[model samples]
Target: MEKYINAFTDSLLNTLDYTWRAMTFDVPWYTNFFWGLTAISLLVWLLEIAFPWRKDQSIFRKDFWLDTFYMYFNFFIFAIVISGVYEILGVLFNDLGITAKSFAIIDIASWPMWAQLLVFFIIIDFVQWFTHVLLHRYEFLWQFHKVHHSVKEMGFAAHLRYHWMENIFYKPLKTFGVMILGGFEPEQAYVVHFIAISIGHLNHSNIKITWGPLKYIFNNPVMHLYHHVKALPDGHRHGINFGISLSLWDYIFKTNYVPEDSGTIELGFPGDEEFPKTFWSQITYGFVKPKKKQPSN
Candidate 1:
């Protein structure tokens, strides 16, 4: 018990220190995710300004600052807050003799760096896609996910506006993908990380792009915009376009729904009109059981 407590405290402090270093650019340029995310966001924002799909939407659209705050909050602040739980779990797993290579599905350590990265990207992307489907499929999960669907005006920062609980769901699956590869994480894994971030930012940005024929492979703003639409298809009450970085999953699973490319389509879920707008409320929004509707005679 004491060991686990101590591990949590040490890990929490280390996470904070590492975050500070990244923010101050004390880390290597390539591994500095803080500034890397900022640079990518700025670049995408510029594209949105230059070629906005919604011409009438303001540069500072609705909830722009709110979504921006969510970006940093989810990325750094939430990680810092949850570091202790992860550290405790790691300590417990270590005591159980469980290693990263314990559940090896295939040995990729001998593979070339490019091969390792490609495999890592594909596996993690599919994990995220599956997790996304869960967020929409279950009502309990959808309550937490509604915070993301609350975006009436999508932008680059909106990509990270999801509820913190989503991190709880996603990070573990991604880590499992890493573990399944027999701890074959390459030193250049940051390359795949940055690429995912860039793709996510572009997918939510106002700039319309189908990537031409590559649209079948990569998720784009147009396809993702429909993911935020209020109406679900006749059969897919859960959702559609659940891909994170790859459109291939949606295509293969028959969940792809791109009826039109019109940017004027309305966004948000059915009851989102009553959804919380403030951060505090949103973070705590879905905890309580909602009141059931009374039947009318």
Candidate 2:
């Protein structure tokens, strides 16, 4: 009887895996990634149409298309550039006699699949949250990251409106860190990457979610929306909700802000009031120094 039950559970897991692969067309890695991205984008769009956060009514204008185009453009460009660089680096690392085969933690790929997944996400989120905070506090890094914050409106595509250089620098470090630390194989890393990107996009989405108790565990769209809020003149309402996957760090660090009531809040950079509306302007302005303000006579 025990043997039969074990066999049944194994068969059920295999069946579910088969269904997932079938629905995804069992495509190549790159193709699967793109398709996953498209699927999530479509889901977010449908949610926006069905239940938008803001009732101001002009939120779904031509600006939406423009933002969407910018988002896709950045996503593809970063994917190509970062992947190419990582491939080259990986080859060099292989030639230099460095590999994950020597690492015990990474070799835990032999461990239970669920254990591997848990470790991968925890490590990645730790690195990402620290990196994100560094970008905000550091002036030079903020130049590139500001592009992400420049968005006045919150939506699905708003999450991807980042400078390509940000990815070129940030992604390589992240990939290399994972490879060296636990030696998480590229395929496992890829799966985690897809999940993280999907969740990050959803966090930036304008959809309303009650979340309830889950708010303490996972970051919902409503919580993340507050992170993009423009800073007050006195810098009182500046930084909050710095976590990417889990809200634990934010709460521990006193950065988490759970609003009593959900509502559409003002978003964007406080110092840079004249945010560029055009794609080129937005990307280029970050490179140039802002004009100095003249003191009132």
Candidate 3:
């Protein structure tokens, strides 16, 4: 108990310091997640302004400001909030005699930098893709995920407009992926992080990109737009196009779907009009049981 408390204190302070340096540009440029996210967002927003796939969508799209706040909240504020908990978890796992390297299936530490990054990216992307499918497959998870699907207008900022619970789900699985790769994160792993951010922003941006033949290899705006559609296909009750940074998983698993590229299809899920609009309401949105239909009177 004392150890956990100390871990919490130490992680909280370290997280604060890291966030400050990131914001003040004191960290190396490649590892400066704060500024890196900002730069990518700005660049994508500029692209959306110059060449919008949905020409009618506003520069200030619905929930644009809200989503912008979400980007920072999830990236920085939420990190501060969860740092202690994560540290405690690490301590607990260590006490349990389990370490990341315990699950090591391969040690790519000695692999070429490019190869290490490629394997890391592919494994992490698949993990995220699977987790995304689970988010839709389960009702309890979907309730939280509704915050993201609540988007009525798509844009670059929408990429990060998800419930914080998703971080709880994703981060652990991502760590497990690293564990599988012999718990060896390469020195240049930031490259994978930056590329994932760029692809994710582009995936949700209001800019058309199919990547031509590479559409099969990577997620793009067109394919991901369909992921937010109000209606699912006949058999896809959960969702479709579950890919994150990579579309290959969807194509391989037969979850990919894009009947047309009209770019005017309605976004949002059924009854999204009733979803919460405020940040506080949204972050806490999906934690309770719904009233049982009163036995249909």
Model 1 regions lying over 4 Å from their true place: 289-297
Looking at model 2, residue 1 earns an lDDT score of 43
TM-score of 3: 0.96
**TM-score to true structure, per model:** 0.96, 0.77, 0.96
lDDT (Cα, tens digit) per residue for candidate 1, span 135-166: 99898999899999999999999999989999
- In terms of TM-score, how similar is model 2 to the real structure? 0.77
Q: Where does the lowest 10-residue lDDT sum fall in candidate 1?
A: 285-294
Q: Return the TM-score for candidate 1, rounded to 2 decimals.
A: 0.96
Query: What are the lDDT scores of the predictions, listed in order?
Result: 0.93, 0.69, 0.93
The digit string of per-residue lDDT tens for model 2 on 1-297 reads 454455445555554554357446785654365567777788887777777776563547436777787766776544543443455555566767877544434454566777777777777787677777877777778788888887777788787777766776667556655675556653456677777877777787767774788787778788888778785333434467878877777877777775644655777877657666677776776676655659899
lDDT for residue 203 in candidate 3, whole number 0-100 = 94
Per-residue lDDT over 49-72 for candidate 3, one digit per residue giving the tens place of the 0 to 100 score: 999888888999988999999999
Query: For every model in order, what is the number of clashing pairs?
Result: 0, 1, 0
